[model samples]
Target: MPVSLVILAAGQGTRMNSDLPKVLHQVAAAPLLHHAMQAGLSLDPEKLVVVTGHGAEAVAKAARAYDARCDTVMQAEQLGTGHAVAQAMPLLAGMAGDCFVLYGDTPFIRPETLEAMLAARARHAVVVLGFEARDPGRYGRLIAEGEALQRIVEFKDATDEERAITLCNSGVICADTAVLADLVSAIGNSNAAGEYYLTDIVEIARKRGLSAGVVICDEAETLGVNTRAQLAEAEAAFQARARAEALDNGVTLTAPETVFFALDTHVGRDAIIGPNVIFGPGVTIESGAEILAFCHLTGCHVSRGATVGPFARLRPGAELAEDVHVGNFVEIKNAILDEGVKVGHLTYLGDADVGEHTNIGAGTVTCNYDGVNKHRTKIGKRAFIGSDTMLVAPVTVGDGAMTGSGSVITENVPAEAVALGRAKQVTKPGLAPKLFDMYKAAKAKRQKDQA
Candidate 1:
């Protein structure tokens, strides 16, 4: 059967203590709602509806960025979970498929677990995700008989015996679209919290003589982020899982705990990453690549056998071909370093293209941006850019050409030619002492006058 997802992102999350919406806060360099959408999208659902409340505009914008097909509805009031789900019914109307309700703050739900929940629908009319909480403290209890769930009792309302049950509701549920619509409409807010509870659907289904079951998952999968500390904890948990997966896939991390990865970081087998390397949004390392410590990379691609530095920054659009070497303190932006290209320390190569076997010496900078416009600097194969050389944009160095050290190149150099753009040296022998005498006398006269 086809499936649709209704994500509840209506909570204000006042505990987060930030101007940004809680779901919009980043974990692993992505919003929490985006993470939830990723898990639900794996099922290839027919429709996706995100219910937004606080900071709805920003939250909706982020949702569309991840899945352009995602539709959004607004929950003007924070009436509770059932009211949040009800706002999505108009969008899902006439859609004949199973609907899965998920929480935006809970992002670690695995695709396999969701698949199992859908499978459970074959035997039960409603399926709620349940977890065996180690400390069932204040969570809602899932009351069940055998494999069939009888009802869900909130901790405030549950009796002492019921509260002792370790099984808790995760607030994720799967049910037929038509059945869920009916159940949500029949719900009333008369409990201790005086809010419409999504869990009440279980009892409503039971009263109608329909069966409700549950799919069990690890407690970690239901972790909800509500504060800065909890967000950090979630990030740590995600990194642990990412590092373990990377190790199992044959990637080596010199110091795994010190390294942080973005949600979309991809490293091929045999890639080695050193300590304190932070990968931002779009990074890919091909097999045999080595990234040294303290390197930060984002939106860049490193090909086979490439070596990036101990203090390198590869910004968006930077591409390193096979056997390329980018050394310490070098920043590359919107540039391509071809195979066998060598860019050493203290260089900035932005909006430029270097051909195969080219050597970019220390302090070499491609002056790509003028006061008004940005341009490209092109260097051909085997060209040598000497130390402290500045290649002003709209300039090109032909194949096998060389530029003198400290040269400021403004025009093209022909193939196999040497370009020296510095002024001729002139020396006055034995003049150092006279110059020092003059300076000393001026300093003494100025001091005497002041006194």
Candidate 2:
């Protein structure tokens, strides 16, 4: 049977206290809706429909960046979840398939949970993900009658006893498209808010005497973010999960709580990560690579046995080959440092390429950006860059080239040559005593005049 995924992103999420759409808020360096889209795409669904409302243009545009082929539906009015899904009804226009309805604000919803719910499929029935929480709140309470879901009763619509049920509704449901279409049709805006909640479908299913089952998962997996505090909580949860996975893969994190990893970051076995390091997505560190504290690395590759700083920043396009050493206060962006290269202390290497066995001294900078466009600097094998030297871009230091301390090199140096570009020293032989006497006389005369 064909399966489709619909993500509802219709609400303004006013509680988040920001103008940006709730789905656009980032978690783990990716927007929340991107996470939802990634999970949906992993399902290999026949069709993926995104329902946008409040920030329709922005959200639709962002979604297109990720998957241009995805179909978008707009809810002109902010009614409720049922109305949001109703917007997507046209995408399912002629196709009869099972559709998994998801929320854009719930970025942490796992693909496995969706797959499990899909696997636990029963034709002609509703399957909603559920969790047993301490407080059900405004969420619909999942009341089950011994393995069978009795009904999802909301707080206002639930009895005192039913309201007290610990299992809370996750608002994620999988249903036969035709059955879901029928369920949406029967739902009326008769509730307290007068808004059509899709949660009403479970009760409607029960009233129709149909089988509605609950797919019980850990409550954390379904904790939707509606505010900044909840968003922070969700971020913490994602970080914790990523750290645990890293440790399980033989990577050791000292003070794991202080480290953050993007969802797609790949770390090899035995890589040690210290506190306060942020690994953005597309970062991959090979085995024996050690990344110390206070490092923010994104879109970089750290090869085997390499050591990155206790305070290094490796920006996008940085590649540190095996045994490379990048020390504190070094920022490398769009640069490649070959094996045995040591870039230590107070250096910025942007749009540069350094060959193997090179030593990039402290306070050295590749003047890569010229205010308008960027240029590249190349350092050959065994080249020694002296401290406090600036190698203007479009320049190259050949193999075994030695740059004198404090020299500014604008032109390329030939292989095995020493490039020392500095003003020649001119010294005067001792006129020091005569100059000192004149200064003493002048000082005395000035003092006498003042008196």
Instruction: Choose the strongest candidate by lDDT.
Output: 1
Q: What is the per-residue lDDT of model 1 for residues 1-451, given as tens digits with 9 covering 90 to 100? A: 7899999998889999988988998888989998899999999999999999999999999999999999999999998899999999989999897999999999899999999999999999999999999999899999998679999999988999999999999999999998999999998999999999999999999999999999999999999999999999999999998999999999999999999999889999999999999999999999999999999999999999999998999999999999999999999999999999999899999999999999999999999989999999999999999999999998999999999999999999998899988888999999999999999999999999999
Candidate 2 positional error at 36, Å: 2.4
TM-score of each: 0.96, 0.91
By summed lDDT, the worst window of 10 consecutive residues in model 2 runs over 115-124
Q: Check candidate 2 and list the clashing pairs.
A: none
Best by TM-score: 1
Q: Flag regions of model 1 displaced more than 4 Å.
A: 440-451
Q: Provide C-alpha RMSD values for all models, in order.
A: 1.7, 3.1
Cα lDDT listed for each candidate: 0.95, 0.89
Candidate 2, lDDT over the whole model: 0.89
State the RMSD for candidate 1: 1.7
Tens-digit lDDT string for candidate 2 (94-169): 7676899988888877889988888767643899899888667877888887557777777777888887788888
